[model samples]
Target: MDHVVVEPDSSSFSRVARALDDEASGEQWRAELATDLHAALELGVATVRGSLMGMATGGLDDGHEPLRQAVSASVESQVRMSGRGAGARIRARKITLRNFVNAPKRLNSRRGWRHPVHGDTETWVTQIGAPGWFDDPLRRLHARLHSAAARALDNRARRIARRG
Candidate 1:
């Protein structure tokens, strides 16, 4: 009778076990991943804010400088991550301009309105603003925001998976 024997590979098992058992390394890895995610969010928010600022300030009546500034200043973003999932929220923080909390909405939808000419009796003119000021930039940048987040996760995964 002939007999055959096989030996189990120990090196691979040991490496995997070491990696799993190193709690400090695991925690550090998690912290780095969170930092990377946060950095990505910051970058996305900055990009969106710049785009919003450009859109808010451009191609308007040029009469509502304060409104433009306020809208531009109101751009804000938040990132939330949990055991289940992660999310990013981009918005215009409520700004009270003329006691209007929805100033950004008003600016985005405002059409021509009757305005009295300065020092001119019985004379009035219509002032108009370019509509979709707020929504247009966000719509245009949606793809960019998604891609940025995906790239961040991909990069971190690649770095973690890199072998010596």
Candidate 2:
């Protein structure tokens, strides 16, 4: 894959983090950076997460899946969903992900999710160091988990294969 390198937008994370720091001082603890981080995370890493979700449930539904494939030609999703980001460690999520799609790719030195806000796409690296942690690990884990889930559901896969 031809990896695109996108320089991080300098002010995005800081702005969000600063907003969190300023607005979240009360005892309710309902609002905090961690919570903010959780919500903000999906924006940047949706692609990676979506991809994992697809792989994990590969055979579950033929009708549809999340982020179902890579290199999708249609505006509709190409990759499938699974579940997988944040932080300038708050700016990157703020700026680039405005129109971000969860197409995570390993960049040089930094693992990246492509930033697609502007016309020309740029692959901005995530603050989270590991790019596709949910990626290969999920693929490996899914093979095991999917089999296990199938067994739990009465070993249907083998039966289906044997029937075929």
Per model, state how many residue pairs clash.
Answer: 0, 23
Candidate 1 structure lDDT: 0.61
* Number of the predicted model whose lDDT against the real structure is largest: 1
User: Residue-wise lDDT of candidate 1 within 36-80, one digit each (tens)?
Assistant: 666655654566456545652323353554666667778766555
Clashing pairs in 1: none
Off by over 4 Å in 2: 1-96, 103-129, 155-164
Worst 10 residues of 2 by lDDT: 88-97
lDDT scores for all predictions? 0.61, 0.35
- TM-score of each predicted structure versus truth: 0.53, 0.23
List model 2 lDDT by residue over 81-132, tens digit each: 1234212121111111223344333211144443333233564423322444
Best by TM-score: 1
Error of 1 at 39 (Å): 5.4
